[model samples]
Target: MAKPTTEVALISVIVALFLVSTTFASSDAPFIVAHKKVSLNRLKSGAEKVSVSIDLYNQGTVTAYDVSLSDDSWTQDVFDLAGGNTSKSWERIDAGSLVSHSFVLESKVKTMFYGAPAVIKFRIPTKAALQEAYSTPMPPLDILADRPPEKKFEWAKMLLTKYGSLVSVISIVVLFVYLVATPSKSSALKGSKKRR
Candidate 1:
């Protein structure tokens, strides 16, 4: 009786762990990641450029399609960010029913650069010209959540800009220690001097 009960419990635990692990597994789960960047030129005129990027993956037994640089408000148009990359792409696209469709973006950028960039919203719908792409619903972002946090990694900036004196003193101390550890030129020459 005890042995059977222990076996059942062990089997249950194994099944539960397998399910949990598979759920979080990278290859098994389908996910998409997007990287967007936008910049604004204070001196430039209202001229703007836009860049877009996309990455799609289908972990299940179906194909993902119709990937687009979709901001219905036409927002990603940034202006005068000289020689900047505005769009991103995936490494490669795999083929198969459960295949993932990754896309690269190169449209406009100035509009998407700021969260308040004319309030452009991005949506991934299930529209397709070749394959039936599934629609992915997007939830509204928290009004304040998108704002940059008041506290930031600003300490590094302070060290770079305002702590120059401290950095210089530390560098001087390090140089002194290095010099003391090294044999002096006079000492090295003394051993070879024949008469002097």
Candidate 2:
């Protein structure tokens, strides 16, 4: 009688685990992810330019609808829009799809600027509430002060870092060829001297 009761209890536990796994596996939803990148370029005219690029990816099983992206982090006095709009919208992004947006900001004044994350909003047909997400945040950027004159030593160091290995390889090959050729010439000279 005890063995029969233990078998019944084991069967009941197995049935419960199977039900829970199926319930979670049946859920299908759309998940949106955003990544933001910022680059600073120094121009020859003593102005700094900030380039911003944002990428949106849908990692969910279903398609996302009514997608929008907005970035209003820079102040009007600090940055001027050089090109491209800061806000964009799309009708939909399919499952496992990617979209990208970019803009450039030019700042003539030298100062430090703090940035905020870009906002992303989307909707699901089955859900009433609008889903919201934010792109990755960026740290503070220093647009402050004038860049000093470039030194020759600094330029040399940069060149060395870029082409030092290639130069070394060429030098080694040239040295090896010279050493091999000189040995044959010296051997011929020694043979002539012995004959004389």
Screening candidate 2 with a backbone cut-off below 3 angstroms (N, C-alpha, C), the clashing residue pairs are: none
- Per-residue alpha-carbon lDDT of model 1 for 1-196, expressed as tens digits? 5775466557656754664466477343223332233322222333332333223444332233343323333323422234433332233233332222222223222222223211112222243233222123222222112245466768878887898888999999999999999999998898779566
lDDT of 2 at 81: 99
TM-score of structure candidate 1: 0.26
The model with the greatest lDDT is 2
TM-score of each: 0.26, 0.66
Clashes of 1: 19
Model 2 TM-score relative to the real fold: 0.66
